[model samples]
Target: MHRKTIVDVGTDHGLLAIGLALTGKFQKVIGVDVSQQALENGALSLLSQIESRRKGIDPQKAALDVPVEFRHGDGLKALEEGEADIVCMAGMGVSTLLQILEQDHDALTSDLNRRQYTDLILQPTNSKPRNLMFLYKSLQDSGWELRNERIVKLSSRWYVTSHFTRPQSNIPVTALIEDGAMKIPGSTLDCTLSDSDPMRQDLEEYCRHHSQWIRKDSEYGRMDLLEEVWLERFGNDR
Candidate 1:
């Protein structure tokens, strides 16, 4: 069994970390941010959340003593080698996320990574298909296999949250990437949900330009379509 610890890198308000802690699935949650101010704010939020939960009627929820800590540092510099089983980098751009990983490759790309395995929850704020494709391609080339994928349109910006983990030795890297484009299933681009709004119009143009080369296949190219849930996933259902 593995240690059920999570390290939230670039955790802005620690909402995701707090939510994970509340689920009681993870034993510990660490919110790491570059800005000290952000850490302070998240600490306050965590404190307030705990206090509020303590006042609730659900004794079990209130009694949940999941530890949530905040650290101040850029990217993965605040993290030690194999410090957590899961690392989340959300609400960031594709380029910024890649830069962070590139800056601290050894810590994440260790032999321990293959043996112990680490889950990475990456949600990029970038809307351009080309950039997202680049990030996806980079992850594959670096031996991170996709476990889950989500496409969300939050307040005019489309976000793709890719959950990845250590590559299984048997499976080969993705061959879908071709001619700067591949197919991304269950997306506005794939399903043709294009509208005429100015922002979406711009995104639509880019999607059209790279439609052939930017492929984010459905849940690792699963055969059965789970249209009931709006997530595009791969690997295990969890």
Candidate 2:
């Protein structure tokens, strides 16, 4: 419930933006999409939500104080510099997400009004090693530091939601790649295997799946670094 301004990139039907606005947490929620029809649909959906609230159809009690706006554009094209303190991109492939982040980097470096620190929330639908590695390297390269991450299992599929921030420049891309490939220590692995924390358990499952998928695909480059990232977060010694 932070009073931050959020811009949802590739916001199809505006569900995320509208939902956030309904929470009365953000100062503004802007849904940006490439399609006009999606914007129209999202507007209608938001209107319906507002109508429901007016009629007391929905009972939660949090008044919708945030203003939700919809813009039509690709990636960050619809957003002006410094307009949003947070940017969210979800339900898209890693490649598309990378493109959007790259564009944001370019904009940030070029624009005078771009904020010094803008949070990036990403949910990449695909779990390829190459994709994951690319995301990792790209974030560091673009000056965004990985602050937190979570893995969720849904419908027998694994999805990762990562939170990043534009912190001070970090390790080199090659070093990051190496970090992700580093193997988890045996002791750390044992601890995570038996940890009762749900997030830790989900991470263990995510590692198992990610390791298997990457190995099956013969994407050997990221194996060690990926495991290293896991250990860095959940390892007993860290």
Candidate 3:
């Protein structure tokens, strides 16, 4: 796989950065944290490991360089525009994450156009399904599309990671559906869909059948209320 520039926002310990660097998955890796102590500790921990690795190499041998750096800052403020090809914001609350995006919207927009950022990885701290819906709509309005999503079930919570990209002229219809909606081709309700994988056809059929009950009792007034709430919260900026 081709190496890409990667930035991890709210990186508490910098383990992700270290792992990516050591694995050579990223040409450059940056770990950003708001806490100075956390940045220092993470940097020290990574440096110690690098030093340990160097000891095993011959004095005359050139060591494999580690491609990572640690920085202390609020969100992407410390990063230069167009610096990273993949931006990751993990282990943060939905509102906090939204605030970060709102604060750096202009910079991010410029970078997205200039560098053509291929991926945005978001891992929310809590299972806020409504927040996720809000985020999805926000991204869509901002000219971005959800590329992929995964819900990892842990002992206590589900870690939801969503990957997004700038929207293109023609997106596959299968990718336009939201979760828990009808998946039928001619259905009124949209289900979580994707065109990249053909094997998901059965899943689409299942969603179509499952959403029949919801469509029967669904209230248009309730949906309007939800839309109003989202608008009040997110505003026209999204």
Quote the RMSD, in angstroms, for model 2.
5.4
How many backbone clashes does every candidate have? 10, 9, 2
Off by over 4 Å in 3: 57-64, 105-116, 169-238
Positional deviation of 146 in candidate 2, in angstroms?
A: 0.9
Number of the candidate with higher lDDT, 1 or 2: 2
Model 1 lDDT, full chain set: 0.61
Lowest-sum lDDT 10-residue window in model 1: 227-236
Query: Can you give the TM-score per candidate against the true fold?
Result: 0.65, 0.74, 0.66
Off by over 4 Å in 1: 1-3, 52-64, 105-108, 111-117, 169-238
Better of 2 and 3 by lDDT: 2
Best by lDDT: 2
| Candidate 1 lDDT by residue in tens digits, 145-209 | 66665555556556666777775442222443433122342242333433554445544444443
TM-score, ranked from best to worst:
2, 3, 1
lDDT of 2 by residue, 1-238 (tens): 5588988889887788788887878888888889889777776567566757765854654344437888888867677667788888899998888777656555433331255337888888885444665676666655566666666678977777777776565456666556553222222334444466566665666656555655554455545654445434543322
- Against the true structure, candidate 2 reaches a TM-score of 0.74
